[model samples]
Target: MKIVPSSVQLLLERLRATYTAEEARLRLSRQAERAPERTLRSAREASSANISSLWRQLGAAGVEIAGVEQELADQRTLEQAERYSGNIEAMVGTVKLPVGVVGPLLVNGLNAKGLYYAPMATTEAALVASYARGAMVATRSGGVTTALLNEGVLRTPGFKFSGLIDAGLFVEWVARNADELKAAAEATTRHGKLIALEPIIDNDIVFLLCRYTTGDASGQNMVTIATDALCAKIEQDCPVKPLHWFIEANFSGDKKASYIGLITGRGRKVSASTVIPEALVEKHLHVSIDRMLAYGEMANLGALLSGQMGAQGHYANGLAAFYIATGQDAACVSESAVGFTRMERREDGLFVSVTLPNILVGSVGGGTGMPSQSAALSLLGLKGAGHGAALAEVTAALCLCGEISIMAAIAAGHFSSAHEKLARKR
Candidate 1:
């Protein structure tokens, strides 16, 4: 007789009771009250035990398992990809994302400069095509010039004092002892370096925005650990101890679409720009330069009226795709895509630029090491430490190209038609 090598959980559960010599009745203590112990025992004794009683119990309760049959088909191979430990509550197999490619885009940046392909994982049908069209235009018009605009990661540690006077005194003390505070913070991590400790006073609270230069990782956890270390040191040595203190006061603007993160820049920020001649715009984008410029103004006005944070055309589309393909923390897209896009006609042609103020990324951390995600990064040749900035510049250049194609597609009355053909074909 042969037993099926089944789901590890199902195997463990069945054998635990059988080998322990515990009767099925005693084992069903946490089980449903409806199924009598005798029936459970009979079900367990059945030769085809794995799919018998428990599944029947769940099925009787109006639950379905057919859809998971295919998902669990290759349980063994899927189990090997399980990279999580200690924090493991349960392991459900991976869901697949459809990854596509757009670009042979040209980017001129301080760290990365070349023609590159962008891998985009998205469900939207016309998304990759829109970006490809944008990249095509940029490539024809030379390339987009990119710059590393700013670099910093912040963790806001908040403190509460009895009165405003105490808060003011605390702020002064922090300012005076910045060197010592930095030393304490630096003790926690090898890669994170303490750069700035900015204090903000609100009533009786002191919000110290602890900023750091994180080398290769996204640095959220790095900065948080270091700041906690600094906060502990402050609690021990400061003359006026805070009435209450918390690790995060929400000022770091981790995921929020705040103006502070937009201006001060929470993570890697890069700007990509290009000047496309009027004739090239017409040939590739199928729109006149003057009309495109007019449309830019109109779009800007609409964004202002709608209270939108980012005025660019479809910044999220490219950023979200790139993030998914590169295995970034997807939630960062909320703040990462928030920026200003400006377009002005120059004597040469058109001046188009996009400033992505925050692109929280890492080459050595998070999900970047996962099998498929690692392949994606390696495909782009982005590897090792200090490559995070290079990724940001590439992403910004992709965004610039995407913006150009989309704005032009809309201006040339191709938006609906393009989507109708690519997005919803019968």
Candidate 2:
């Protein structure tokens, strides 16, 4: 479907025009003339009347923000945000993303089993509805099965040597002292466990990607700190150190797309699958299961031809909403959404699955503790260390639901119509 690009200029102009009422401008001018020496900040500090007068001055100054003013009309206070975030400035109210619940999406996972009302935060009009539709069909078909297949957070520390022999010798030394390196890494964190050290050997350079299993947390920060300690230990202990050594040669796949993440997986490696009964497919999705399979074939061909990272439909649509609602590091969406999804004709119905190798999500750290984010997680029955594994599985399940919905839309040729009806404001 074609997406209409938003114009920041146009939005700003509307805000300006909407709030710049002639009466408001005139009232502000009279007030300003009455007390030309009055300052807005002092007025705002004085009383409610002065605050109203201050807003008038801004409006009279040609700033149109009546809508924004109305939106922040009852802003409680900004002081509390400092607990969850750093570098606090004045509280800038809120950007109220409409949150919608999809499901009773039944999920069977190692940690999470049962029905959930998945909270999705998004601006797209039909996104929540689409996911909810997929969830309904999946629920009727007996739910998605999710597995936490693997877990790791990586930090690749690089070493430079004079020659191949020197680099090879360093690699040998590191391997010989693997236990000590592991100890050094583990010493830094109570929850992080040093699981493996994977090496990439160039002629005269070596990159040791340290992998860790961080319990119940995404553990990017935990893994990075542990890797730093390990590197320091190597510098101090390895007598035949490289001519130079540095932490993070960029092979760890932090906050960016890389083959390393796609292959090795930097966070939770999760896979979710489901079988939709034939009757349910046509009844709920309004398309034949075989036609969905054909669309999948076309999409896979296109992904292969275009060298796309993920061979799936609309993984980002669900993942972005999920992450934003849950207060996950939304940037992780870049890596998390690169999913491998498949659909095939089955004897009874259609078999579908989504494999998300690097689903970097957490229920404890980062934005999960913030009020809105916490509420979203709580809505899903996920909000702490114990729920991390379940969160990963749920993420995979949600991705599968989205893949089914989007592919069905494309296959049925209703993608554009759906968007035209739902995306545009009436």
Candidate 3:
């Protein structure tokens, strides 16, 4: 299916003239300035003095030293420091962020079917307030409906061959010996099961896209380990030995946005939708349905023009905050943020929906074991096993709330003013 509908494409083409040349000029003019050349001193020696010296160097470089060392040290106990062994390299200290709660956000989904107070960790002001407003509107309008559509984690390992014929034979061998490969992959992990192995040939390279269902975990590392074992077995048994092979072929769209991920999905595929009454829209957002829909159309046009993989307003904002708060892999947000947002006019009100194909989140692994993150997950009652689906659903709903709120703000011409009033600290 085409990501952007034909009707919307035609509409954008027709309205292309409305986009002023000055606006294009301003956008083209905006560029990043070059940074000053300076190297911060660091030592391999782990000592208080070395750390202090680094901080002093930063201070000398005109950086604000906001007692970050003291605050991080205050939170870090010896036990907590021990816990950071595998999670960090050359452990310095932990930075604390202000976590805000937005809730009583009612969600009606297959897994998430209750009122959840989602904790968002961020420094951006008014973010929590904006989501809270949308949540309130959704709750008042009969709650957001969500669904866990599909779930799988992928890791593609590539094998290099001398020519197309060798690669073709290898692909045939992989297709015929699926059972053996599955057994090899499954042997590495108890919870993760090898669901499918698709072989794609590119001239002399053959990429085996291995998909897995990781129980209650995001499964980046899990899939890598499993795929590694599978590759080892392939190397040992396959008659047509490859010239070389690598664990990751960069075809799985790990930690990066890709059209394949948008289509096939890399992680938990989820969708959330809610209807806001026209009266509620005006009451809360101070915008009419007509204006909101118009703005949404313009936003969609902008997304298409910018070559965005999926059309949506700020999925990263909610995903990033939620991931950090709930101990998810924050880097996964790159792919996780790819989604489609639809806002259509309804008889009673406006129907807003968000479909996120890549929501890489888990309630059991990674940072979920951390004390602060665990507490945050517990706050939403989404800690430990059997709650991964619910966590994904809640994440989709949270993103839906953000989409509604931001679209309304932009339509009502309150986007900049709200940021100025709330974000700027005089």
Off by over 4 Å in 1: 1-63, 72-79, 84-89
- Each candidate's number of clashing pairs is 0, 1, 0
Cα error, candidate 2, residue 182 (Å): 0.9
Question: For this target, which candidate reaches the highest TM-score against the unseen true structure?
Answer: 3
Candidate 2 residue runs with Cα over 4 Å from true position = 1-74, 77-79, 86-94
Q: After superposition, how far is residue 344 of candidate 3 from its true place, in Å?
A: 1.0
Q: Give the clashing residue pairs of candidate 1, or none.
A: none
Candidate numbers, best TM-score first, in rank order: 3, 1, 2
Model 3 spans with C-alpha error above 4 angstroms = 1-68
Listed per candidate, the RMSD to the true structure in angstroms reads 13.0, 9.1, 9.2
The candidate with the higher TM-score, 1 or 2, is: 1
lDDT of 3 by residue, 1-426 (tens): 799999999987876676676876776684656455777766654345545676678778888777875765554433365554445544455778999999999999999999999999999998998999999999999999999999889999999999999999999999999999999999999899999899999999999989999988998889999999999999999999999999998999999999879999999999999989899999999999999999999999999999999999999999999999999999999999999999999888999999999999989888898778989999999999999889999999999999999999999999999999988852
> Candidate 1, TM-score vs. the true structure?
0.83
The total number of steric clashes, by the backbone 3 Å criterion, in model 1 comes to 0
Q: Give all candidates' CA lDDT scores.
A: 0.82, 0.83, 0.90
For model 1, how does the per-residue alpha-carbon lDDT over 1-426 read when each residue is reduced to its tens digit? Answer: 547566876878878867665665577567576665543222222122333444455556566867663463235424443443211222333567799987688888898888788789999999999999888888888888999888889899899999999999999888889999999999998888999889999989999988898888887778989999999989998898798999999888888788888889989888889999898988888999888988999999999999998798888888888988987888888888898889999998988999988888888777787666778888777856768888888889989988998899888899999999998882
Evaluate residue 279 in candidate 3 and report its C-alpha lDDT on the 0 to 100 scale. 94
